[model samples]
Target: MIACLWARAASRKQRAGRESNREQLTAAGNGSAGPMSKKTLARPARGARGGTRRRHLTVLFTCVGRRVELIQAFRGSAERLDIDLTVVGADKSELAPALHLCDRRAVTPTVLDPGYVSALVEVVRSEGADLLIPLIDHELPVLSQARQRFEESGCLALISDPGVVSTCRDKIATYRHLKKHGIDTPRTWLLEAFAKRKSRSFPCFMKPRRGSASFGNYVIHDDEELHTLGRRVPEPIVQELVAGFEHTLDVYTGLDGIPRCVVPRRRLEVRWGEVSKGQVAKDPRLMEIGRRVAQSLPGCRGVITIQCIMSARGRIRVIEINPRFGGGAPLSILAGADLPGWIMRERLGEKPRIRMDGYTDGIRMLRFDQSVFLDRRGELL
Candidate 1:
C-alpha cells in the first residue's frame, strides 16, 4: 500500500547529473569504489505524482535525541531518490535539540511509561507516519513487542521481532548464541559462575548484562576488583576481554533478515562508549565475520550493529550485538553505504542495489558537537 503511494508520488524524475557519480560512494563495504554505471537509472521522484493530494513518506523517530546528522542524511538521500521525506521527532522532553528541526515534533511519555506505545501509535496516525524508528537500545524490547500496534496504524516499526530483540538485549544471550553457532566470541559467565570457577583469568571485563553504550562497564584486574565492582554493577556479567583494535561493523539487514551491506570501521577513539574517531577497515576476515554473524543471528531486521575486537595477529572476536543503528552510523552513510537510502528504496517495493562489501574503505569520521538554538519561547530562532 505504501509502495503504491510512494510510486504514484514519484512520477517525476530526478536531475540525476552528479560529479564523479562513482565517487558519490566509497567502495561497497568490502568491495572497491569506482565509477557508477551510467547504464543504471535511479527511480524518478523529482516532484509530486503530478497530482494535488501531495503525500510524503512520513518517518517518525522515537527518542530523537541529538541525531541531527541522521535527520540530514535521510532528507538528502530522499531527494537523490526523488522522495519527499517528512521526519517526526518524538521524545519525552520538549527541549530535545533534534526535535526543533524535524518536520513534525511529538512529545510523549518515555519508553518505560505505560502509555508510551499508545502515544506512539497516536503519533503515527496523526503524523501519517509510514515508518517508525526507535533510536535507543533501552526501547528495543518495548518497541519490538508493540510493533503490531504500529502496524495496525499502517506503520512499520524498523525493528526485529520481540524474541530477537530480547535475545539481543541480554549480553549473556548474545554470547551464548554466538558461541553455540560456532562463531568466535568472547567467553562470558554469570557473576555466580565466576566465583565458583578459579581458572578465570585476571584482567577480565564486567558490565551489566543488559547494559547499552558501555555504561556501568569495568575493567577488573583481580578477584578483589571483580568482587568489589560486581557488587556495584546491576546484573553484572564477567567476560574475557580481548584487547586489540576495536572494530564496529555497521550492517544493514533487510526486513527479510538478510544482510545487504556491511562496513567495518576501526574505532580510533571512543567517548561515552560511542565512537568519536574511526576509519573503515575492509579486511576480508572482518567482512566475512560480519556476514557469518548476521546470518547466524535469526530475525535480524533493519540496521544491525556488531562490535568486535581484532588482535594484532589478525584474530577477531565478537563482543556486542545491537539490533539497531549505531551512534556512528553517519560514517557508514557518508562512506556510501547508503543505508538510509536503501531502506527507503526497499519500502518503496524496489530491490535495493546493494553490495555486501561495496562501501568504500578508509573513510574516516571525526564527529563533533553541533548546537541547536531556540528562544525562551521554545520556538526555533
Candidate 2:
C-alpha cells in the first residue's frame, strides 16, 4: 500500500511538470501570459516520524537574504554549543559561514514553494533537524507548521506554538495579546483606511502591521505626514513616539517555564536596517518586564528579544517582542549569558548555570566597514 501511494505521488509530480512545461510554452508563444504564479514557493511542513528518529541537534536559520552581519554572530555562538548550524535562506549562495559550518560550500536546497511547511517536514526527516530556530520573521509560518507536524510525528520541535508565533508576528495581534495578558505596550491603533475623524498629536510612529528589519518604519511628525504614510502602507499603525533611551532585553527561558538569563543591551548604532553596535547593561527593570512577557506567551521556548522604549516620563514602554534569536544575539553572549550553550544543555537534560557579570558598563562596540577584495586572479596575476 505504501509503495502504491509513493508511485501515485511520483506520477502526479510528473504530470504536473509536463503541464507546467506546456503552459510555459504557451506563454512564450503569446508573449502576454503574465508571470507564472509561484505555487512551488509554499514552504513545507514537518512530516511524520516513521521510526525512532535520531536526536541530532540541528539549528535551522531562516532568512530572506544572506544576512552577513548576523551570520558571523550566529556561527560563533553555535560553535560554543558544539552543534551543527544549518542556515536556510532564499539566496543560499550568500551564506558563506553557515555553508562552511555545515562543511558544504554548496547552497543547501530551500523550500521555495509556499508549501514551506511540507518542505521543512521533509528536511526535518532527511537532515534530522531536531531544533528549528527562525532567524527571520518571514519564516515564522514554516516554523509554525513544524510545531504542528511534530506532535503527530512525535518529533521534538524546539519552537513556540504556531498561534503564539502568528500573534507575535503581527504587531496588531501582538499588541492585542499583550493587552489581553495585562502586559504594557505602546499605545497603538490600526489604520484600516485613512480616517481624519480625530487628529493624533504629532511625533508619532507609522509602521505596517506586519514587517521586519524596519522595512517600512517611519516617524510621522504632522497630520500630513501621517496621511502620506497611511497611503504608503495599508492598515498602518500610529503610535506615540516615546522619547528616551531604547534598550533590548534578551531573555532565554527553560522548559520549566522559568526565566533563565535576561541580558540587557543598548543599541549603540544601526546600519542597513540592523543593529550593528550594542553594549550590554545591567537593567533590573528590563529583566523583570522580560520575565513577565515570557510567561504570558504560550510554548515560550528559545530566545526572545524584548524591545522597549523609555518614555520621557521615565517609564519603559514595551515596543515589540521578537520571539526568536535576534540579530544581536551574540551581544547577549558577551554580556555573560551563554545563551547558545544554555539552549543545548537544556535540550540535553543537563542543568545550566546562568551568569551575568563583567558587563555592568563601560563596554562599547562599533561596526565599521573594512576593505574587501572582491575578485582576484590566480598566482601570477
lDDT tens digits, residue span 310-337, model 1: 9999989999988888888888887888
Residue-level lDDT tens digits of model 2 in 1-381: 122332343234334434443221111122233332221112222211212333234444444344343444434545555444443322234433332223111233344555555544444444344445556676665666667574343234556667768887888888888888887787778764324546567787888888777778898877777777778875588776788777788878765646667777778777765677888767777777888888888677778778887665757778888777777766666544667666655654557776533244535555555221224431110
Note the Cα lDDT for every prediction shown: 0.77, 0.57
Q: Could you say which candidate leads in TM-score?
A: 1
- CA displacement after TM-score superposition, residue 187 of candidate 1 (Å): 0.7
Q: Which window of 10 residues has the lowest lDDT sum in candidate 1?
A: 19-28
| Candidate 2 overall lDDT versus native | 0.57
Per-candidate TM vs. native?
0.85, 0.72
Q: Provide the RMSD of all predictions against the true structure, rounded to 1 decimal.
A: 11.5, 12.5
